[model samples]
Target: MKLKLTLVLTIVSLSLFAQTKYSNEFMNIGVDAAALGMSNAVSSTTSDVNAGYWNPSGLINVEDNQLALMHSSYFANIANYDYAAFAMPIDDRSTIGISLIRFAVDDILDTTQLIDDQGNVNYDRISLFSTADYGFTFSYARKLPVQGLNYGINAKVIRRVIGDFANSWGFGFDAGIQFQTENNWKFGIMARDITTTFNSWSYDEESFARIQNAIEGQNQELPESSEITIPKLQIGVSKSYLFHYDYSFKTALDLNVRFEQNNDIISTSFASINPALGFEFGYVDMIFLRTGVGNFQNELQIDNSESLSFQPSFGVGFKYKGIHVDYAFTDIGDQSVALYSNVFSLKLDFSAFR
Candidate 1:
């Protein structure tokens, strides 16, 4: 009976928690609807404040100060995700940006374990709490001495809180470069968490100790420690093909790879390459339709089964005057679990105001 109870609790923990080898997993989720809509293939073609998150060097393409906001519902209303960013040009060759992202779940049932003198279980003691994550970024980009080349960097701070039980703070930095050709082709590379971010965690020791003791006896080690996040690199290319009367098609592709210690997902110093492809069709750069597919990996094993494997995304956007509205839906595989998300975004271009 004891063995069976342990197995059940383990299964419940795996199902309720997200499993990741790195810290601050929430930050790994894409921020803007426009980017996610393109399956995160905009590393090279990002042209607005969202560039701060994708590729800061792309901020050079913004003609004026821009503000971008996005909101998404994930996993059938299990959580709320939001993002906001602002970008401003300092001169013809320099730009600055600021961004904030938050992900949270509220009013979770916190249950208490109770037993009477006869070891009878009690189920009436349940409370509620919240879990949240926040990220703040400041960025700067400058056109290099060579025309058509740009460089940028970001400083980020992250915070995570869990229902008064534990909290963590982390810091990281990212760098990127972009090169554009006369023929409207663009190439970009970004290195995220280059210094390898570190998260220092603190917990309500007494409470957690008691819980741990009850769950795994007094000999088991409790959860406590600082974690180091690994770095990731992404490379991308984009091009626009023009047809008749300002009609055009924009296409982009990106490859992302992570560098970390030997682990289940990453067995070598460098392993696992994910590819993304996206296309946008537009008339006069106003009305647009987009589709993208990505998250190609061997681990999940692409199939028509109920497993949550690779995700395909679709999006649409419209540009009018100085405002842009965008929407994207991601078909997260595993129909059995019904996991999917919808994202909406709005952008305001200040160039018209100027």
Candidate 2:
């Protein structure tokens, strides 16, 4: 039965990747700390508490109690993301977690204008508006000793709030499988964002009724309706090597190929390949330095310029007793200077039950 399920998941992932019109909404909200470290490639390893966001199957390797928090400052004055997660082992072979992620787009200038009776120039005042996106996740992982494998699933409730305009709600799921060979080879697979698109992005008529009445009273124009769709579908694989040396060194490489199906005019289905590599060196696992490269692609042809850019990232981590602290920096390149596309994240981990 497990084999059959895995095969089905593989087929569905491939099919989704081949589809066009990918949505880009909710893309920036899924960010996490470990992901910030390796350019968002924490899909396989069970080394940290952030695994709940990347590959839940990794939870099988977790012991005792775990708590983690991650925050990211994104491009623009738009929004910032904050993530928190907690995991605990139910047994030697089972683990469970709960996580929350919030994306907030701060004060934005509201451009709606109120004109005078004669259609003459009138004073305009900027009103502040903002958007908030949030998600709640419940995850579970269990190990199958017979196959030397571990599997997990995550169920989520997603919500979005855009000022006084409209709000949306949706549901989604993620699944993952991981295996280790007797020779110490590790392999993993994950399917993310599997669910239907949100269709509840509706506004309160009462909020706009006042404006509508004013415009109607003056025989002016009315506002048009607008909607947004959240993107879905991601599949990834990862592998790692553990080298036995005087000082232990571990290296890992992960690849994720994502596809979005556009459902609205603002989104277009596109394909992207993200590859990440990280190296960890330490003695007795006290301190470590990690660096990686990701998002390598061909020339990106924009309006008037052709640019080739890839995001590179670096991080450092420290472990004391059962507490861990990690910091990472990611570069967004200069293709669009105004975008200010750089990210920095910090994570704190604590093992309460261990």
Using lDDT as the measure, the top candidate is 1
Give all candidates' CA lDDT scores: 0.78, 0.60
Candidate 1 deviation (Cα RMSD): 4.5
Report the C-alpha lDDT of model 1 over 264-315, residue by residue, as the tens digit: 2224665657778999989898988898887754343357433224668888
Tens digits of per-residue lDDT for model 2 on 107-224?
7544333345565534364355666778888999998866768888888777766667556676667788877777666667777765534434455566444334433553123222
What candidate 2 gets wrong by more than 4 Å, as runs, is 1-32, 113-126, 196-199, 206-246, 259-273, 300-308, 332-354
TM-score for candidate 1: 0.86
Per-candidate RMSD vs. true structure?
4.5, 10.8
TM-score of each: 0.86, 0.74
Q: Candidate 2, which ten residues in sequence have the lowest lDDT sum? A: 11-20
Residue 331 lDDT in candidate 1: 61
What's the C-alpha lDDT at position 169 in model 2? 70
Query: What global local distance difference test value does model 1 have?
Result: 0.78
